[model samples]
Target: MDFMIAAAIAALLNIGLLGTIIVIYVQNTRLVQSYFTYGLITVASAFMVQNIVIVIFWFNLYTAGPAIKTIVDAAAPYLFVINLAQTVGLAVMVWINT
Candidate 1:
């Protein structure tokens, strides 16, 4: 029960983050013309896709038992790497742009 609640909360927060990024992207498509900004956009897009996958997995986890959690745990490493790459890319983009 606790795990399900936590996963639900995380999904909600990630959705909010993705929505914010989309808003920013829409407001300034011009930024993506630059190489660094383009990279950021690409990584962010990938992160969004990963987030969607995570949400699906999390939803499944919520309904399923402890065994399903192993799948989610297995994905953690991949998610961590992608998230790290995205974070670094975001920092670089900000540094380069500003």
Candidate 2:
């Protein structure tokens, strides 16, 4: 159950990050070249969303009793895996960009 929940959360997180970029691009008024200008902002926005969510969940667990945190605890492992994947993905993107 925990694994499943984590998987779902991770999946949602991945979709959400990508969706942010896509939505920004779609709504952008400038030419494609403007993407270069937005590049840093886009990456910052994505990272901010990811970290803010992790911090919120981590804080929730820390502040809540175990009984209340039981469900979220189960999802921790999956979140860990996804977090590692996301970190690696960001690393790769940075490498490629540089």
Candidate 3:
């Protein structure tokens, strides 16, 4: 599939996950009141932000000059790995706190 197509799909999935988490936060304030819950929210937000960045990167790659696209391409993988680590850390926080 094309990069833009893939990025659009990722953005939709990220939005879905963010929406679900927000709903969870709203529905179970008791469970979502803890520091771990905050951490989860933060991580999820960061993950969504990172995906947004990736989508921007794809947009730039398609529309921008080569230099800017190169920079975005170089940075996107690092952001993805950082987001992945944050996700794992959030999972650990949930496991430890529960």
> What would the per-residue lDDT of candidate 1 be over residues 1-98, giving only the tens digit for each residue?
34444554555555556556655665566744566666656766776787678768767764587777777666655555554455555545545544
For all predicted structures, in order, the TM-scores are 0.54, 0.54, 0.54
**Tens digit of per-residue lDDT, candidate 3, span 1-98:** 24445445646565555656645654565755777767766776776677677667667675778768667666556555554555455455445544
**What are the lDDT figures for the candidates, one per model?**
0.60, 0.60, 0.59
True-structure Cα RMSD, model 1 = 5.3
Clashing pairs in 1: none
| lDDT (Cα, 0-100) at 65 in candidate 1 | 72
Per-candidate Cα RMSD to the true structure, in Å, reads: 5.3, 8.0, 5.2
The clash count for each model shown is 0, 0, 0
